[model samples]
Target: MVFKRMLQALGVGGPSVDAVLTSPDCRPGGTLEGAVQILGGDHPVDVEYLAIGLLTRVEVESGDSEYHTDQEFHRQRLTGSFRLEPGARHDVPFTFPVPWQTPITEVYGQHLHGMTMGLSTELEVARAVDKSDLDPVAVHPLPAQERILDALLRLGFRFGRADVERGRVYGVEQELPFYQEIEFYPPPPFARGINQLELTFLPTPRRLQVVLELDKRGGLFTEGHDAFGSFDVDYATVDQVDWVAKLDGWLRQAAQRRGLLF
Candidate 1:
């Protein structure tokens, strides 16, 4: 019996946990269904609770510097206190709601470069916490978001990379503290005066807020600068608008006018 207990014990005689997701792909404002599988340790343990959360890498700006860190934005408890007998197994099912402001990690079927999102599972046993490895999750764009992205591609912009920044966007009602920036290289026609363009989407249930930022290229006698613009589209009429033309007009005006502010 002693040898059997020793053989069946988990690392350090503590319980082990594995969180499995039904599907790794989901959209913002959707639900992620999964179950936490727990295998008890060599001895009985009083499990305080089980929790799952959504985490992502966010760029934080400090005084004269910037760094990246994993931030857990939302969490849901799976259970209350329970007794876990030695070598016993427990499976707790959960339906975790994804925040409306969650960042997109994939476009179409391809994962966005420089972007990472995962589900973290933590179990509290007798005041001791055991965290499982992060389970990767893909957040796809909504219909309106997809239209905007496709419009940019149609306008001849090439995708560079994407990342989340730890700050609220000016002039936008934000429920989450972080926002994502999708970077793109300017098309050839506008490449002379503009170096790059960044796009941010702030979506609510009724409308989508789009923010555009352009990095202006410096001329021989002029210094480089940045310009910002924002607009909103009702979700119901997303398909009615001609996004390609709308975006093209804005891009042209931004490139031609050096000091334009919108």
Candidate 2:
């Protein structure tokens, strides 16, 4: 309680807030249930508002350089103005909806390197400054997402790292300002032609949109370049397709410089 309390805004005696999540793990399009526990300070104070949101680190490209910054993509207001008496505690329950395009931060119980997710609670006092609290959150992949990731592993792609970028795919439809890229090293078979592979998943309630990017190695006659491919899968038919064979074929085509339009 002491660590969760915000003592700077209202000095030694001010309202403090802590967001307690029932569970820190969830998938996209799911709901995160939690309670906002607010404890009054030594005196009565007017609360301006209470809110919670999903926060993540996003990489932003500026000119020729890129930087990372914290971004709150989704938010929910818990309550409006309220009055708090001395030493009074209030618990407000909330159900925060995770956006469909929210990035995945964990897979197979492992935290993806360079990726982070959190639920942030913000409390604004009428006359004092804003008090805030943050709790780490783990975003797991949907069933369809898991299938594709498993396919990549079966295809011998070693997981490299993952990151969220603050931009939209050139031809993909996205509801959020940022998207995630999971990087992997090519298998031995395709290592000579393909240097690296990157995967991005944009999922909805009914369908999952997948985008693939390949870093092609330079040949004696051609220069190194990148190859792109996009496709969709219906959630109802996710298990019908052989993702490993599909991905291997696509990678082979891209490695041969034939075509990546799938």
Tens-digit lDDT track of model 1 for 96-171: 9998889999998998999999999988777444547589999999999999999999989999999999998999
Give the Cα lDDT of each candidate. 0.87, 0.89
Total clashes for model 1? 0
lDDT of 2 by residue, 1-262 (tens): 6543455344568878999999999999999998999999887888889999999999999999999999999999999998989899999999999999999999999999999899999988875677799999999999999999999999888999999999899887799999999999987877877678999999988799999998877778878788889899789998999999988877777656643222
Clashes of each: 0, 0
CA lDDT, candidate 1, residue 108: 81
Estimate the TM-score of every prediction: 0.92, 0.93
* Candidate 1 Cα misplacement greater than 4 A, ranges: 1-11, 127-129, 259-262
Q: How many backbone clashes does candidate 2 have?
A: 0
Clashing pairs in 1: none
